[model samples]
Target: MRKIIFLGALIGLIAFSCARLDSFLFNPYKTDEYKLDAYDGKLQFRLGPEFDIPQDKIHLFSISSQGYKIWGIYIGDTTTISSDTVILYCHGNTGHIDYYWQRAKLLAHVGGKLRYGVLIFDYRGYGKSEGEPSEEAIYEDTKAMMQWLKDKGLTGDRLVIYGYSMGTAPATYWSSHDGPLTPRWLILEAPFASAELMVQDGAYFVLPKQYVTDLEINNAEWIKNAKAPLLLFHGTEDKLLALDPHGKTVFDNHPGPKQAVFVEGATHSDVPVILGIEAYISEIYNFIKSH
Candidate 1:
């Protein structure tokens, strides 16, 4: 009867983990509250007919992510993929690629010249991407993106990875794990140290420690082996993760050539504009050129 009892216990454990899987891995806010097609004059850019349709600027494409379709957009001219230095912009947890096109526009101006191209995408379960969200899932999806760039002849130093907020997971993951495919320059903005720390601080700080699942982003451990020149920026007044715990920890843990900027009085999403576009661009360009 011992074998039967053990089987029952194992089944119960699997059921519990399956039930909590989505809760642990993703915080997807699936709502039609935002439709990028109607880019109101009030907002800079939207993914809808009103915006991209007018200029038809965004080139939409698909990539295979674990047997499912995931979406990505090229924010500049079609030739820019071949001509310009590309930064694959991995955005934060909430919202889709439509919400981040404005960021693409800002990153296009590299050191006062339109030198950099931007590619932004929605992970599975975020925007139009297929399947559910998980740490490995996001990593493979982003790996497909790097392959796309290689196929387009953008290789080695020409490609850069930039991660914002929750997007830092895949950004750090690829840079640390992707061997030859890894780019030399990595730009991380408001990065979380790890999955558990992020959920602990943001979700349930008061509760005791628990290992609900193996959803480890592991940015701290990943950066130790990352040889690339890392440019990290964090806001002092961030409403989400505090600079002292999250960003600072990641910066400290990195054992490579790195530089960090602490923006005074700036909160999350304010790194670009708060420092003034020209100066911020200069900082980015200097990091890119020198590295």
Candidate 2:
């Protein structure tokens, strides 16, 4: 009887831990308007006036993702939506588009000032987007965005998929798999390799990823089949994802035309700022120009 009781208690403990792990992976805050100052306490520097985007150029809209309405922002001339090369940016798992608005603005200057259209959106269960969040939901949400782009006359050859941190999972997955559209280039910054690696990193043991979370995010493996030329950036001092286990692992596993830059002192959140905006833009511009 004691053995039976102990076994049941152990199972209960494992189940509870798994649920907690899953919840801890995603951190989102609700917002009706973009409060840039909300993240001020955590970030060392706020986006300056130089990064201000023109109100006329800023387009906000929503699309249906798995029957849930998700919001997206496009920074460019709508008149050129069909002809311009667009960068579909997948932001990190955190707050809504407001938290990443600055990053999207930076991408608008990638090739040149407003040379390319930049698109970013909030996934379901985040910000104003409705419904719950999950691994499959994110993938479908991202796919829905691609479909919207396709309907706008943007072809796979003119699309660039850029993913940072938690965003890398869907970016890598869609880039490799047969999806709504294929990207001409793949860019990853501060990418986590897989849920298994995440589990290994946090638990300090070789535990199965399923034991903690049902998330099957695996950029390291999915990247192997990606045909688009890859440009990857990893901060050497990234404490959140780390260099060796996460970013480097994904870079090493990729089997295609690839370029990697391990920024000297950049952290998980500030790769572009630490790498220098000019240099960051140059790297992406050159990559797109060459490929």
Candidate 3:
């Protein structure tokens, strides 16, 4: 039985939180949306050690929600921390750090002209991270990592939060709710409307909206409060979540400075390719610089 994180009942149907319905209606893999632990489970971060390991793997473990350990890797050369901008990437559901390493390398170069470092982690229950996965738990994992960055002298407008697919939830949640810890920019690639809406096409609408376990992302409710510039990108040919109510909907909901980029023939995860990597990076670079 899945633990209920919120309400006991909703609209008089069977009461279930989104966390409970998560596995039932979404792809458990990608929906993991969240891993991070160092080479070992130790909490310390070390510089390039003489030991043989994967390239650019700066493994660090942070105390996550309820004290779980989050397994993450900082991809970039040693000069990354000294760079003015660091992108804290919240990846989509599924897989672990190894699965995202290639892309992490690419994203780490997004603001190369300005020298940006990219940090991506796996949520608990995914890869090397500890504990189970849940709504609030994932946010706590992000907070733990964000705090880790803060403690290392990274703060203020120097940070950029990037969310892909299901990751938009944590990115937006933390950006809007983190107070002074807020990022200078928030970017969402292929964001969905909400948990209930996300499960609709895949779950075939079998569950009533009212009773769909409330793994609610509810980005619409939070984007309005974001203090940083928001960038939303979605494919016109998205085959999973629709573009209208999901991407466009959230883009419309944002109340702060923002830009919406629609790639003509792009599909989910291929926006960078479709838009031309140089062009895409330029847009992001200009956005962050202007703000």
Q: On residues 1-291, what C-alpha lDDT tens digit does candidate 2 reach at each position?
A: 999999999998987763546766677767676554344435434566676777888888899987798888888976787898999999888777878877887888887778899999888788778887777877888899999998898999999999989899889999999998999999999999999999999999999988768788999999999989999999999999998889888998888799998999999988888999889889999999999
- Report the number of the highest-lDDT candidate: 2
At residue 46, give the lDDT of candidate 1: 29
Q: Give Cα distance to truth, residue 165, candidate 3, Å.
A: 0.7
* Candidate 1 positional error at 245, Å: 1.6
Candidate 1 stretches greater than 4 Å from native: 1-25, 29-37, 40-57, 80-83, 199-210
**Model 1, position 212: C-alpha lDDT score:** 48
| Candidates by lDDT, descending order | 2, 1, 3
Q: What is the lDDT of residue 54 in candidate 1?
A: 27
TM-score of each: 0.81, 0.91, 0.77
For model 3, the stretches where C-alpha displacement exceeds 4 angstroms are: 1-20, 24-64, 77-83, 199-208
lDDT for predicted candidate 1 compared with the true structure: 0.74
* Whole-model lDDT values for every prediction: 0.74, 0.86, 0.70
How high a TM-score does candidate 1 get? Answer: 0.81
Expressed as tens digits, the lDDT of each residue in 31-82 for candidate 1 is: 3333444433333222222222224556788888678788887766666566
